[model samples]
Target chain A: MIARLLSAFALAGFSPLLWADALTGDVQRQPLNVSAIAMFVAFVALTLGITYWASKRNTSTSAFYTAGGSITGFQNGLAIAGDYMSAASFLGISALVFTSGYDGLIYSIGFLVGWPIILFLIAERLRNLGKYTFADVASYRLGQTQIRTLSACGSLVVVAFYLIAQMVGAGKLIELLFGLDYHVAVVLVGILMVLYVLFGGMLATTWVQIIKAVLLLSGASFMAIMVLKHVNFDISTLFSEAIKVHPKGEAIMSPGGLVKDPISAFSLGLALMFGTAGLPHILMRFFTVSDAKEARKSVFYATGFIGYFYILTFIIGFGAILLVSTNPDFKDATGALLGGNNMAAVHLANAVGGSVFLGFISAVAFATILAVVSGLTLAGASAVSHDLYASVFRKGRVNDKDEMRVSKITTVALGILAIGLGILFEKQNIAFMVGLAFSIAASCNFPVLLLSMYWKNLTTRGAMIGGWLGLITAVVLMVLGPTIWVQILGHEKAIYPYEYPALFSILIAFAGIWFFSVTDKSKAAAGERALFFPQFVRSQTGLGSSGATAH
Target chain B: MHDLAYKRIEQSPQFKELVAKREKFAWILSAIMLGLYVVFILLIAFQPQLLGARISPDSSVTWGIPMGVGLIVSAFVLTGIYVQRANGEFDRLNQAILDEVKQ
Candidate 1:
């Protein structure tokens, strides 16, 4: 079915090519170099081989979905980094910092901080009750049907938003590098992503992510080092140079100089920070590990790796600022502003490091989009096949083959949907979509997970209400917020003042859970709630052994 | 298998003691997060001149950037605390849980 759909889409895209060519009067296009073609072929072969290997080993549903629950701490750690880093971290944030200066670093800081919270609070519990999806943990104490339904909603929301961002990024990169039409780029990315996830499942996704992370980090690190060398290895001097280059005596060292509004600055920070913990694709990686200790260790490694990556981005962004300020060509290029800030990092690497760096950075950027989209597809598949179909609709009776079939189908469907959205919203900023994903995740999923794990009095009623309220509040705020309303819809004055919605969603979710839990006595268990408080208290004081001995 | 693992951990005195300590630390960390979030919101709401006095416009130092840096630092510190605890106390607890599950 997916193959047929791809063929149809490809044909449609090609139909317009002849007309476009005739109108342009045969302008000679630059052909793909031998090296570029070879590299592209090699990447395809490696990814496909991994998928085939995973398919052969997946003897059961669990194996296909979660790698038979046997992943190691270090491997999962690398995979976590692979999964979370995405194109947004590798490209988007760097581009943001390159264009906006200090405000761009705020996004990096926000994402990096979520690891500690996950390690300290959520990791072990999630592993202990691990099923195929996050809803497994939330539903462990609640009714299966309720948890499954809510989990599906939350997962879908997150995956849809995240996938659109990645697809849009892929389209832009394809256009930039290969000169492909926008629709063609979208369809190509969608097909490739579906092939990766449908064939290999978790094992394939994990390996892809790990390989992408290594390449991405190494490539970015190399470029950053080279960039610093150009600056004569002077870290302090870069800041001074940046300060000297500013147009309006803008504060180079403060957030206030970056933007005019204080409220927007605070809201952006809040979205980035809290949104990391709530990301469904990220949390799902916890389940891929064998145990809780592994989960915790993975967080530690990911944090370290991610931290170093952010530091490198600082160099990359600042280097671009310096380079562009001096170069007439880059200064005249309006692509950065029109295409959005996400292109700044790539443009900088291309300009400063030459064609070799441009090709390498572009390849890594492509891989970044691929790895993240694959992860999102897997997460979405799990929510559909594992949570919704198997657990709720089929009562877990769906056999291994049937489950795999359903999951693959869902992956293809999702990929197509993502491609459609990407083309439709090509002009919009990918970061905005990413931020919306985070807001939805934090608002809808975080509260339910936190309350269920810690608050014993959290009844089924409370969980449902909290989850729905969070989902609704986040969606509404995002729709009415300035980014979508004023900027996208051209409504001069948006109803909601804030650009970020996580803060509002977080507040609404917490309030709903507390209010609902306090008033409902029938379903609430007082003793369980009391025990959780002490357990939480004890965990904080360094009393508990980190080792996950099955008590 | 699941019941046996649960029982083994529940029976271990060391595991019980560790759980208590971990819970305490969790509360403290949560409190810190809540407090930090409050201060962040306050700084955003009221942009005082004192906050920007030392941060020159030439360098891009504002209340928001410093506060963001602070959050990042604190997050790392908390992660370090978790690592120390895991290496020391939580290691034993996790081992106990694994041993029980394996048995």
Candidate 2:
């Protein structure tokens, strides 16, 4: 399918840049580059084929939601890694490393530490208990309709904030690769991702993710090795050269004030660590695997792959500083990077292995965006179709065929919503938007999910109220915080000082859950508490749990 | 696997021990990892110079480099240990309890 996509790209091959430049009314010094388009077309075709295959067989809600829970440990591991490493992580994180040096490592560490905690606390238990969503686990012993309602809100809110950042990043990547207008690229990418989920479902999404992961890991390794070779395999020389070229020099090796104060640091730390555990997309990946064992194994493999990838990113960033910084050809007439800092890794690819490799990396980067958006869209679709339509509105009376239709319809709605938001965000300064997504996931979803599993006294009223409180606090504080308030809103002093609201919002959620649950002496609360033991046993042992039935 | 069998297992002494051990172990590991990460954040937020201190006079390598690498390595190491226990001790005891109940 990727090859077919490449052929299509080749068909649109000539004068693509000329047309784009004409529309933008800007002429470029560089000529039209067909190789990059070829590589991008090539990569996407593979996923299109995977989507075709996954769509043909999957007709039921189970298959649509969790690939009928048949994905093996290793494949699921790659998919998890694929889902976690968004195009932002590929380009934006690398760009952070390229610009701020050690601050980037701090960011990567915040992401890496979350995986072990997921393995230790979540993976197995989450897999055993929940058939489709983590909301399943949270609602198992509580009021199903209310809990699912609360969590669906939480999930969709996360998907929206996260989807905006992803859409922007995807637009940027496609613009770089295909030379299409940014809005045009965003729509194309959005439509393509929707198709992947709308037809292919989880199975298609999973394979696309797996393919992207392999491509990314191999692409990064090739670049990193070539980088090391340039310095004659001497690590110290690479660091020393980086220090020389980087404007910040020794300061770049330190924190460099990217994480200004204590509250912000703590909140950012909490958001990054716990946020991974809360993300509906990440949580939903566990359902794709058959059992608890495969679930944990997938986490293990994902942790290793992600950890290794971050280390490579660290190298790639510094490597860019050493090579791309000094090279005049990579610079614009104004003497800055050609496409700003995020292009550092792409420039590094061109520097190390010439245009072919640059095309290869760019294609992989575009594929990375498509794969991630598909996963996010599927999670959003499931939140609507399964959690809302089947469980809430229909009260679980809906059959598989109708539920599958809801999912497909939701995918198209979300795709259009994403494109609309993508265009609207074009003029917005959403630098903190990614943090807001993480903040919401950490504050709202994490606290509810964790307390619901660990604390038996958690009533439905508590979960619902606490989750909304966390959600409200995160959104409000993020809006009032310095990034948006001072910068975007044109305000003087901000109401909230910290960049991240997770530390405080999380506390609010926990306190609310505790206060509400403890004070409730009602019969419903008693019944909810009584249900916890059965839920706990099923979560642990898989005894009488919802085992996967092949569709 | 009937509800009675599950209820019996849940009420058993061995099952109680397994639950206690696993949760305790997970909490401890989580605490350790979280604690280390918090310390790193503290150092970044407060004692920047300490993290900025050069590891050796001769080289450009700073404390943060090895520290960052060590933290990444630690994430992998901790995961390895958990997987080891899950595959070995935890799974074994879990199977034993299930087999005992079945018998």
Best by DockQ: 2
DockQ, all models: 0.26, 0.49
Computed on alpha carbons, the lDDT of every model, listed in order, comes to 0.67, 0.81
Superposed model 1: Cα runs more than 4 Å off: A1-38, A246-250, A259-268, A333-341, A427-431, A483-493, A523-551, B1-13, B27-78, B93-103
Classified by CAPRI criteria, candidate 1 counts as acceptable
Per-residue CA lDDT of model 2 for A1-551, tens digit only, reads 43332222211111111111001112122344578779877777877888899888688888899999989888999999998776667776677789888777877776788788889988887888788988898888889999999889889998897888778766756676557778887898899999889888999999999998999999899989988998999887888889888888888887664422445655665676788789999999999888887888888889889989999998999889988989999999888888777678989999999999988887888788888888889999999999999999999999888998898899999999999998898666555666677789888888888888889899988888888899999999988988788978899999998666888998998898888889989999999998788778777877766666773
Query: Cα RMSD (Å) per model?
Result: 9.5, 8.3
Model 1: per-residue lDDT, tens digit, A1-551?
Answer: 43333222222111111111001111122234344445555776888889898877666667666777667777888888777676656665666566556555544664565577778788877766656787877776576788789978998988888777677767766666555576876887788778878777788888888888898888888878877887688665676677677542345444433333334444445555566676778888877776666777787788777777877787788877777655655543653332344556766776777766666776776676788888888899889998998889998787877887888789888888888898787766455666678778888788888787777778677778888998898889888988688877899899988666766788888888788777777624454454454344323321232222211
State the weakest 10-residue window (summed lDDT) of model 1 chain A. Answer: A16-25
Q: What is candidate 2's TM-score against the reference? A: 0.92
TM-score of chain B of 2: 0.95
Question: How far does residue B14 in candidate 1 sit from its true spot (Å)?
Answer: 3.5
Docking class of 2: acceptable
